[model samples]
Target: MNPNDLVQFLKKDPKDFTKDDIIRFCEENKIEMVNFRYVAADGRLKTLNFVLSSKEYLDTILSDGERVDGSSLFPFIEAGSSDLYVIPRYSTAFMDPFAEVPTLDILCSFYDNTGKPLASSPEYILRQAAIAFKRETGMDYKCLGELEYYVISDVDEIYPGVDQKGYHESAPYCKFAEMRTQALLMVARAGGKIKYGHSEVGCFTKDGKYYEQHEIEFLPCDPILAVEQLIIAKWVLRMLGSQYGVEVSFAPKITVGKAGSGMHFHMLAEKNGRNVMVKDGKLSDTAKKMIAGILDIGDAITAFGNPIPTSYLRLVPHQEAPTYICWGDRNRSVVVRVPLGWTGSTDMAIEANFGLKRRVEKASKQTFEYRVADGAADVYETVASLIIGAMHGLSMPNALEMADKLYASGNIFDKEYASFLKKLRQLPTSCSESADVLLKNRKLFEKDGIFPPGVIDAQAKKLKAFKDAGLSDKLLGNEKEFAKLVQKYIHIG
Candidate 1:
């Protein structure tokens, strides 16, 4: 049994977890409830609980998962043929931190009536896309999500924080530090490879409602697990909010003029388990191909990356978000940004200590960040689309040329590069436009039959129903209506 782990399991890694091991651990730890959790069509976690009355009952529950109404969970499924099975993955086992009773929670994958992996399931789609990418390019597409959100609460004005000046702000001046720290610990304990957590730059008070933004970033891993980590982190954050008598929102925007939450994804290419995004202190060719692929398909993916009406509002100019489709090194105003990756830098420890020697060679930390995604994104579908886009770029003959032509120096929005910014493409400004682009470019995602046509049609139909062509303009100068709109979507994750 590991003392550091919340679950007293003998296995150090959850990948090595087995059914027998889970049974033994539950019996020994007096776990009363076993919860099977999975992501439904609406991009929220659903759970089916079981009570462990006896060993035989426990074995049966673990061996053969229970049936669920697929029609209720997924909009595409017909009620007549909605029966589906959910089988738990041993690697996702964790103890429910919010449960009053001892409970073991394991994330499940969906299966159809024929016991085949559900083709429309987001999990299955992402898995197939990854396998196809690896088979085609002999390299892996690793990604990490930068999940940002605001913790809304009703508090007194004793300790107030300034608006848009809360970057890395500490306690007394900044609130919700305890909530963020607990979320970070729970995420790490639940198999999320967390990088760090901190206060963000969008803190303010409006009508007795306080909004403080915070972000929890994860280390790079396989795309499938990366999305799972984000989903789990969101679940934990919401659970904590409920317990703390506050509100947690992953909404893209809470008001008209402030920083909005963006779920940016940093991606890197790896071949033979070695980073290939940088070599000789310069961007590698493989990395450029990935950037080109994202640029080519950025607009179309907005259907999954920015699904809500308010998502377009967040992409407006002067908010530090991207409006044009372009790529640049460490530029925040472009859709695709190559962040500072510690390239050509010496060891910091050696520089700080006079007598210390360099012990190991520097590893590449270069990543291509897709800045178009927001909190309303369908995590699984969005990542699957990005992976397919990368594969497309790798296969394209003129991918490198495309990347070179779209590169901008410094901020693309700067007056110096105004001419170049105009030449670049523009991202969709409304959900209607995104739906149109997605339908037009459907062939890009359907090339290898990874994304089902039905799925694409459903998303397009949903986005078109919003009818928010000029929602931002209409809401301008109407603070009452804007506040109502923000409250309506203040809990979207």
Candidate 2:
């Protein structure tokens, strides 16, 4: 069922939405548990469980959401003051096909003691930006994230299959063929629209041994719903991986010297049901502004989009994870790509319960993809921050003209592109540099107070401290430093 069904079930408050109808729906699906899922500031998904069989218990908990000790959360929550409330949105409800207990899961947002929405909360921050985007532009934005990851069995840890190249390899050659099918099923059941998934061109290496790498991609949809699907998809993969005797890794660079995974975002804008990004059979002025916005603060936003040190590892040249600031049409090597729609391709509409496919518009209109981030980035923060940057750039005079000059200057993949973009502008080189960029462009985050100054300060301080501590060089010692770093922050939602 769609979220509208659950929303219609609640006659009282919208968020207090689990009612008899929802109970009946749960019973029909044999759901034994209801899970409330939220992300900490570091983007890790945390869960709070409640029994779904009893309506009274559901009412009690929904009326007064369970309190969380915020001290244990990521940097967004202050250390000394530690009380926050999590309230799940019924609109986020979905059935998990991989859950052993047959659970119902809903993504949640945070609230303060006085019941006000927590501005620092990533979900809340994204929600505020989305609302502002709709109000200011009189247009809606839809985005889909194509997330990539690696898989290996715990029993056979650190084995990076032979030759270290495995992009688009099918069964007999690919061990993940069966597992990928199951992953797509679970993703569809959990309300994800899967465009496609395949093995990526990456090899694993550890202790002087070589192995394999893989990637699964999805079509673009609503930003918030798309992010929620990302969280669920990762959960499904991990849970099922355990059952299948494999471990999943979403780290930017799982192997030290191979191709790194990137979480690319394909975005489009529309107003009155017509795409506003396209005008006169070309990218419109508004589209240029959006691209300008992305390129303008691309490095500053990397403080959130590519949050970790290893994240920078993946941003190097020729790995498919972009390093330079320039954007190119159909160029995967660049930071941003204006993709040409594939010929003879049909627009697909994947159903929530199965792979229900349909045809929609033709693939003539171009879609924008930001390839800087990986699975490690916080969905809410990255999208929200990007939106903030887009709006900020939209306010600039001759923004479209500026964007034209920025990307049309030189071939970004050339030897001189680094200096070329630097002469124009380029992405920050490190966490310290990224933080410095953010501090200089602080107004983008502070507009409308959607992202509180405290949150920006906290992120900046943490990045600065990470730099000062030399953690990039000192996170862990020995050949296992890569694995250690991945394990520390790779599970982020």
Candidate 3:
């Protein structure tokens, strides 16, 4: 099914819908249970479910939310801290297709007893960041996250090394075709608008190996909805895979020396529903400003984008993963790539300027894709940091000019990787390095107290502990240890 056609099923923004609307829908559909999901400090999904039996119970939850132990989720609340409230965001409600019974999964937020947004809540932080940006610029942004993962029957059944080839290979070569279709179809039914799902470039090459790479690219939506869709899609895939006796992994390095999955985000900024990233067939001032801000904080943002030790294994220089701190027009080697038909502006402008009409078919208006993040990172925190960086750039006078220089710098990841290091910095090679950067630059995120005052402190502490333990050393050097670790954490089984 065309993804655009699935838009009609999407739930309206929570702020736009009334409590009565959701209650009415639940009554009409007879959704027997409600699964409330929220993001932990580490960005993993946690759930508190309820068996719905009456409108009164539903109404109470819709208004007051359910209370849960906050201390259980790391870095969220202390052991003695008062229990936090898990308020369901009605807009995120979608049917759980894999559940034994008809159930609704609604993404939720953490709040204190007085109904204040919890400082430790990633979702709330993401929302505050977006609202802060909109308040300052009077413009809103929409985003989409492209997710890639490996589908295999067992964790050990992975395709490794240069011999494996699976990018868009048809049928027998892409043995997981049926799984891909059902996963994408499940995403759509769960209210996500995925543009397309296809076999990816990395897979297990061994004849008997049952491993394949798959990608699901979503259409642009607001920050809250976009992140929700990613989490929902992942949750659904995990559940569906279990029924089929398959293993699904979004781990950065499922296997050493091969392509790792990435969760690239696409974004578009608009003011009064008009594209603000492009104007009159040129890169709008807003677009340049945002890009400049992103570049300015590119390396440090990795704490949330590529936070784990395994992530570094995938982001090395030679692989498809981006390591250089630069952006290029459709140059995947760079950290950021403005693809050929990005936002349609460049494609259309080229035709009008050079009479290349035939190539304008996919021309878009004004959209930007941030390719630095990987699937293993925390989505809410990562996107929030991205928004903060972009908005911060808008405040700088030379942001646009600086962006031009970086974009014109060519592929910094070219043959002379060593030479480019003298000018452009490489992405942080470890969780510790990136955490240190965040600690030093804490003020950037704390501006106007938009993010909680101690967010940086808390995050730094977490990363520091992970680093001091020497987890990265063990994961990278010992294959036996790495396989065991991947089986336990990465497989999501």
Candidate 4:
């Protein structure tokens, strides 16, 4: 389909499109709806197919709402109070390319039986945070992410021999380039505006004989689009891998000793169409304060950012993982990096030259890159925490004072920097500690009742179980064979 035609179709009001129009669009596009399962119930997703046959039925369901038993969802509602509604946002509907019957994918917001938004709904939490930030800072926050993952063949799980190539190694060594190309096309078809896709630098091999396996990274324009692309890309990769008898894993650290996957988020703040982080070609005070705020709240946010127990296996010191809490310009060792050549003018910037004059025009268009998150996290919650934290920093009484205090103190994880970090009252190292932090800071997320007490308690219980099992010690032992062992298990599993 032509981009212009797609745009026109999207512009049409939902009421204007008939059931036939949707069906015809799917037929023309050769879309196939494959597997669909309810997130909150056991019913097959095929039920939606019948409902879509009648516009009236669809509208009634859309208006009256789609009900589901939320008890089955991870860490949400309990079985006793499981009734939840799925209110699909019309704007989020997109054709699922892999669907055999030309299916559509829509993001759902969970609500109680009474029609009130559920506090545990990750989407609701994110929206609440966004609204709060706008109210406080008068800025519109935009986030983009570079998501990286690997594609390999003849693998049940990720293993040492699965991928045997260096970064950007193509052709014989990176045989999965074709798969990535197809996946990129699927992402495009799903309405995700991709900035670019390419092979990244992290690759390794178990068997010395075959060195063609590789990983690919995609950069998406906005946070929402990035997350949608992440989900769609996963589906496409799985389907493509099955065709070739291969597999793909988005595990933060799929294989031990190799470079782990990270969902690196880049954030920018704007107001009234002007970038708030840039002033006179340099990082504005607001930008620095936002970075400082991230540094301040990173530990607590890690519960959502690095959600899984295996995630810590990748955050070891000096492995390009963010074990320390610090931010620096062009410093990969730190948690946040003010990407190189971010000068206010695109011409003067490292990537491109968009000439714009402002106070920070000579300074740089400051963007903060958070390297902490992994694939398993709920993107909505993680992004919400960042927005709220940044806003908190911006509105702090002594923003500059806090920024300088953090910068001068250096890595928060370091022994010397521990004192300063203590002064700031940061989060702890283990999952249990993180849970405690979350419990102590529940007020932060409860401002609008966006995060339910039950949800938090449930997650804390899971974290506690892992902690009690000493799983972290077993999985992260010594950090030397950690990567290799993980790869072996994941590959074999």
Candidate 5:
């Protein structure tokens, strides 16, 4: 579809459009219905054949929704109350570019029979967190995530290459540029507003002899929109790759030794249309406290940021990934860095400052960037935790003291910082440990019933079982394994 077609489609009242409209559109466009499926929170999918000619069938499936055995899903409904429904949100509709017959896609949300939001639903947690933050702190947080993922040549096997070609190495070195361009197009077609896409120098490898490179790029969108983009991007990449016989992994670490992918979240708190993170051309006290809150709750939050066992592989020391709980100006070694703004010059005006700079920079203006999260995480959960913690900090004046202590403590692994780390409470190490921490700290996340007791227990049991079954062992070892072991019990997401 061209820009005009998209504009015409957008002009139509989506609510009035029936199944017939969709079928007619698909038929007119030579789109295939089989290319689409209803994805549920439980990770199960139901196929929708194109043969259905009735508009009511589409209405029932899209609006009336469908029931699923929630007990089978991850940490949602238990066996005793296993009934749940998935309602497709029309706003999320898009065309699958890789389908043999172009297929329409829609993202679904899980709801209880009573129409209440499911406690374990990431979307629910996110909305609750956002609402609570606004109500408590009088601050409106806006986030744009810079998602960095790799596009590998094959998916069936793990191929590790050490290439050091910094950002935008171009052509032969960046073999996946064409694929990324196609992916970006799909993202645009899906209504995701992207700032830019280019090679991430952070994940490059160059041995002076062998030149193999991996491409990394950023896609910018509002917090909710970004999560939606991620979901659709994953699907698009998978579908596109299948067509090209190539595969990609958003896994934090695809191989044993390599730069891990990170979903660096750029967040700013706004009030009455002004960025709250800035004050007098510098980072605001509230922003500092927010940063502190993240560090204070860093360990626990890691559970959501780095949810998978393999995620630990990318968070080790000296790997450009954060291993310590500290923040500094433009220092990637720390968990959070307030990048330096253009100093002593108007050309380097702070207006250009965005992303991490918006939250942490004060003199030059800054923003807070939660650096620990990875692609495997439920984006909603990760963002929710950060928003909640930041809001809590904003409400409490003492949070500044906490932030100072965290900043002064330096690296958590260092002996000198151990005292501060101990006082702040350690983060969970293993997935099971993280789940246990969540169970123990349920009150922190349970506000407004965002995390119910039953849901928490279910997650804990699942994580424990996963650990016992050796999933962590198979995915992580060495520095990553040891780090997880140490922080296995810290409560996070």
Candidate 6:
């Protein structure tokens, strides 16, 4: 059990949090403030603070929730009828590690005046998508995000590190290792099922600023919870960065030639609580359908996964980012990748030590990673699109054929496959192009009214406002211009 988790410490199941329990805990723990946090349309965490005055006030706030102007939070909402309610989700309650006033933070959901979940809310959309996916496919779609960001600090020449060689470095070389480890612990304590945290393959010194890339990956879970965990993880990392007098950026690109951060998501489908992504030492048909489904609407997903202008710059060739829509085993150049896992090996304890007698069998860790998304992505919307696209592919009559045709045996950009790569469809090259593709393929997400029409239009309009068509080519070979663009969006994630 996590010692920092209030729920676990109280010996209560995570799903069993109640208002009375929170009130009692606050009273016993002498908590002074209650923070109601939720995700706004800008994809940032918004907070509503309340100083606990009396038991009656605490009960009322926790039970009935509070109201806020929806128009101000969402661009699609009208001010004339903008009153919306923010109700707390009990399971998301946690102690604010950074709060000095003994505060408790709880994530909230949006509800309309009629007491219905707001259709345009990202949290609601993601929950509905998960429900719909399970109902239609008889399987639960589990997803985990690989969040990558660059931590920037003032350059110190004493222990200066080499450029592009920061992967898994140790103390005295990795400047921010201890701070990142602290963030990992904080996130895990706050209910994020984190897998691990590590330094990545991008380190640079430019203009007396030191930039080092790092990643925090999580374990697979339900789509809604998965996205929530990621959002919280981002918040914790940023909060720690601020306390440490450094800057953390989730932007897709920091330079024109260096390695860029990609928020890659690994996906798996489970049935009866067992992974169904692999079968008989090979990729299963179910997995193929999901891949085919995502590939079918691959361009449309960019509207949510890669929304900003600099996003296209990172999608360029030779950056370990995908330029073409394809899937391959362990291929980083493709949009979808079936990563290597311990699928056929087990009993390592006995093999490593003859003194050991027990043979252990490992659970399946099979999954396919979607490498198209970046840090600028709205976690909820991006996940919802993937689920909707997967459902569409599962229902498609020719999904397997589509997957078969797009499968690549090796690096897609190789000379032998140069002719074949030309025939493969390319992802959107600019923010405007992404908006156009999303508009063209809007029907896929709108089939079950899962994605609100207004939300789609709003996102498209937002992307089009960037007016960044051919922006990558225009900034190519111009390091000064690229640096300006990177600086503008350095803290955008």
Winner by lDDT:
6
Candidates 1 and 4 compared: the better one by lDDT is 1
Query: Candidates' TM-scores?
Result: 0.97, 0.85, 0.87, 0.80, 0.78, 0.97
Q: Write the per-residue lDDT of candidate 3 for residues 297-368, one digit (tens) a residue.
A: 888888788877677777776677787777767667676666644543344456777964664344345577
TM-score of 3: 0.87
Clash pairs for candidate 3 = 159-204, 343-364, 343-365, 344-363, 344-364, 345-364
* Candidate with better lDDT, 5 vs 6: 6
lDDT digits (tens) for residues 316-429 of candidate 2: 666666776777777886677888754334334454536765555454456788888788787888898778766766778878776877674345767776566566565665
Q: Considering summed lDDT, which 10 consecutive residues are worst modelled in model 1?
A: 1-10
> How large is the C-alpha RMSD of every model relative to the true structure?
1.6, 5.3, 4.3, 5.7, 6.7, 1.4
Candidate 5, residue 320: Cα displacement in angstroms equals 1.0
Better of 1 and 6 by lDDT: 6
Q: Score candidate 1 by lDDT.
A: 0.89
Q: Candidate 4: where is the Cα deviation over 4 Å?
A: 1-52, 155-165, 207-223, 344-366, 408-428, 468-493
Candidate 5, residues 1-493, lDDT tens digits: the string is 4322333564654445555565566556655452234444422334444434555565556557677777765545469989887766665566766556566766667788899767567677677777787788787877766666665443221333325434665655556668778878777777666667776654433222222233323343346666666666666666776777665556676444556677787677777766767676666797898888777667777656766565665676666778667776666766776655443345433557643244543343346677888776767777888887786667666888776766642344557755655654444445666676666666776666655566556656656665633444554556666435424421111
CA lDDT, every prediction? 0.89, 0.72, 0.75, 0.61, 0.62, 0.90
Clash count, one per candidate: 0, 5, 6, 37, 33, 0
lDDT of 4 by residue, 1-493 (tens): 4232333565554435444454455455554441222222111122233325444554465455577767766445569888877766554456666555656665556788788987666666677777777788888887776667666444323333333345665544555678777877776665555666667656554443222323434442344545555555666667777877766766677655667777778887887856777676667898888887777778877767766666666676656777666676666667777775446434434335455444543423457788787665557677887887787788777877777765632444557865655555433456677677777776766666556677667656666665623445665546556555455434210
Whole-structure CA lDDT of model 3: 0.75
The parts of candidate 5 lying over 4 Å away from their true place are 1-8, 12-52, 79-81, 154-162, 201-222, 340-345, 348-366, 408-428, 468-493
Q: How many times do residue backbones clash in model 6?
A: 0
Once fitted onto the true fold, the runs of candidate 6 whose alpha carbons sit more than 4 angstroms away are: 354-361
Across residues 1-493, which tens digit of lDDT does each residue of candidate 1 receive?
Answer: 2322534455557777888888888888899999999998777788899988998898888889889999999888999899999998877888888889999899999999899999999999899889999899999889999999999988658779998999999997779999999999888878888889999999988778898999999999998889999999999999999999998999999887889999999999899888999978899998999889989989998999999888988999878899888899888888889999988877777789976897677678889899999998999999998998889888889999999999987877678987887688899989999999999999888777789899999989999999989888898899888778767776775
User: lDDT score, residue 374, model 5?
Assistant: 76
lDDT of 5: 0.62
